[model samples]
Target chain A: MNEKAYFSEQIRLYEQNIYGLALSILKNEHDAADVMQDAILKAYSSLHTLRDRRKFKSWILSIVHNTAIEHLRRQKPTIDIDEQYDLAAPEPTVDPETRHTVRAAIEQLSLAHREVIVLYYYENYSTGQIAEILDLPPATVRQQLFRARKALSKHLNKEDFDR
Target chain B: MTTPSDRDIRRQLEAEGRPAVPDFVHQMTEATLAALPEKLPVQRRPSPFKRISAAAACAALLMLGVLPNVSPAYAQAAGRIPLLGSLIRVLTIRNYTYDDGSHLLEADIPHVEDDDNAEAAALINADIDALTNAAVSRFYHELELSGQGYGSIHIDYETVTATDRWFTLQLRVTETAASSTTYLKYYHIDRQTGRHVGFGDLFAPDSFAALEAAIRAEMQAQMDADPQIDYYIEDEQPDGAPTTLSADQPFFFTENGDLVIVYDKYTIAPGSMGNPAFTIPKSVYEPLLK
Candidate 1:
């Protein structure tokens, strides 16, 4: 197969994963779509940088991750601490009627926590791999996971979930 | 209600993450692919035909018994045709990837592919190794001392110019922390000399003062011609840019053999000016060149 065709097929297979990652990081549909396009072009241009084609999945995702971060960085000089939220105290109570599904609970997470969770739980990257992807320390990834779990427990921690 | 298990969370995460992604390849890549140059310089793949041709050439040579028992006459003739002897190329020797939450590094260091020109290739390769290793070790040293810092360096290279007369390999490094900056180191071989020539080797040492003046004049001319263009020329800015051009200043030659002196960002101007380059027309530097 020609290089172009092969590349197109690969993108076809991974487009959903690309969109998912961008959406989780950007948390906005329009912006996520823009990033998906940017990431695709970026991956296509820099394909030579990847020595092994087998590593394409993680490599492309990392490019998407970097592109998304760069987009966010351009929008604002620095991420505001206020927006990151206090993981220590999540919420007082959960309304039974508005019972948070795991998906909905994840949506409530700050960008910092949301990205790691999605990459880990959804994509199954290891803490070490996640560190490389997100440019974080392995230890920090572990700590974030710990805090993220505590924070999610506020919403997922309920009494009648057996059903 | 009870807490969900990791499996349950994974299922829900899947539900949230997977949306039907449209056929974005055509929509996105067509324009990008069209806009890109026919070939990216960093692409190292040799075509199937080239490989076949190389094999055929080897077989032909062996049929003539040139390979099994090469004659001094053939050796001298083959030396003129570089392909018949050996082809030099650039190869990615190693990729150094590391991250510690605060400090990160991703370097794809390349070396001149070994060939009969091992002596010259070795020199270029050694320089590349030293530059790359120093950057990586510097990151680690900072990580060890402070326990926290935010810096990243990405090393990529391209063969900018390759011909029978001259060969240039550019090692482009981008370092990022609070902000990003780019640095370029160029290696060149004047095929006529068969020896790698640096900026100093190209020009007579005593002539640098004149060359520095020439470069400063170009910087000033650019600024004068366009208000948008700026540089940190002496007395133009408070701190003043370097007044003297060092012998080892980073540079590369044009196809026409013009000399372009390069300065990394924040060296000759503010970061906004980017990497400043001044090309000395061959006519201007001809007398100074060796």
Candidate 2:
């Protein structure tokens, strides 16, 4: 296939993953859409830079990761400290209602924590893959997953009190 | 109710639905393809003197209204001809205007493709796009929160050198809000191999100490020669001098191939001093060149 055709096929196959990754990071559908478009154009324009075709999935996702983070950083000057809580809190009860609570809790996570969790659990990316896409150390990705899970549990448990 | 185990949480997360891709993806793909240059235009090869004279003539004609009647396409094609083509070409890829009229973003992004250095060109383009996007987005976000000011961001690029052996492109970004500041970034490519060059790549690996010493000595002499000139002095300065230079510090080569070390505002001096740059002649470090 020609270059444009190849780029289009690759983008078509990965569009959902790219959108999901952006939404996970930005936590806003509109911003996520904007990031997805920007990332696609950028990837298409620079496809020749891909040295290893085997790593195409990670390469495209890395663009989405950077674009989303850039969008988030532009949206706010300071991080919301409230999004980060103590990770040693007790786990919440796993009732059917916990399923409803999970998404909301995920939205409350800091951008860094939410990214690893979504890439790992939702996208089924390994820690190594997530680290590569996010340009972070694998050890750091694992640590983020641990803290993110704890934070989610704490948020879900706190929701029970509001009820 | 029992507490949720990590396994349970993981299962639920996996089961959660992802956001749907928007309809705009196809539109964006089409737009991108349409914008892609189908074939690389033949480079306008002209002697240095002729190129300058032609550029000057074009500018003169443009100012005289003689070129105004020409169609844009015709003008563009004419401009790309060997005698009329510009030394550097910059094109606007994207622009953003806020609904509230509080801010504007204009990106005159660069791309290098269809050349011997296509891969290097792609890398340079990607880096520039990332930087420009991040800066514009940050400014946009700030404007959204403040909701009371006017601001503009512009990113433009220039070709510092475009020879067969070496290609250097420089990006100048100006962001204006309550205040304005311009940041400079450069991309240097070894055109033959399509490899990006960093500050350390220009010198021998083991010659960092000599470079640092030379730079420090030059900086000191410059300060001594002019009382108005000053660099940041570390509080612990045994000799009241700046710290040692890092290999990764920002630098670029002059037309004469001299090295100019650049420090961002407040990096080596106070913000009022702006970005301070010192040129070290090639003679100073000729032995260090790789």
lDDT of 1 by residue, A1-163 (tens): 7555666677767767777788877777677877766676555545554556776777678778777777787667577543553344455477866655666676677677777777788788886566655645455677787667666777764542433
Clash totals in order: 8, 0
Model 1 off-target regions past 4 Å? A78-93, A157-163, B1-4, B11-17, B22-41, B44-172, B175-290
Query: Candidate 1 chain A: worst 10 consecutive residues by lDDT?
Result: A81-90
For B141-238, candidate 1 gives per-residue lDDT tens digits of 34443342345767777776777777888888876643455778888877766787787787777888888899888887877787555565666331
lDDT of 1 at B39: 42
Candidate 2 yields a Cα-based lDDT of: 0.59
Which pairs of residues clash in candidate 1, taking residues 3 or more apart in a chain or in different chains? A136-B101, A137-B100, A137-B101, A158-B1, A159-B1, A160-B1, A161-B1, A161-B2
DockQ, all models: 0.11, 0.11
User: Per-residue lDDT tens digits of candidate 2, residues B1-290?
Assistant: 23456677666655655656667755664565566444321111111111223343344334324322212121222112121134223343443333345456655555544345566666666666555545544444445433343457776667666655566667777765423446777778775566887777777557767876666777688778875555544462211234555555567777677777776443454333566777788898787878
Candidate 2 CAPRI level: incorrect
Error of 2 at B118 (Å): 31
TM per candidate: 0.46, 0.42
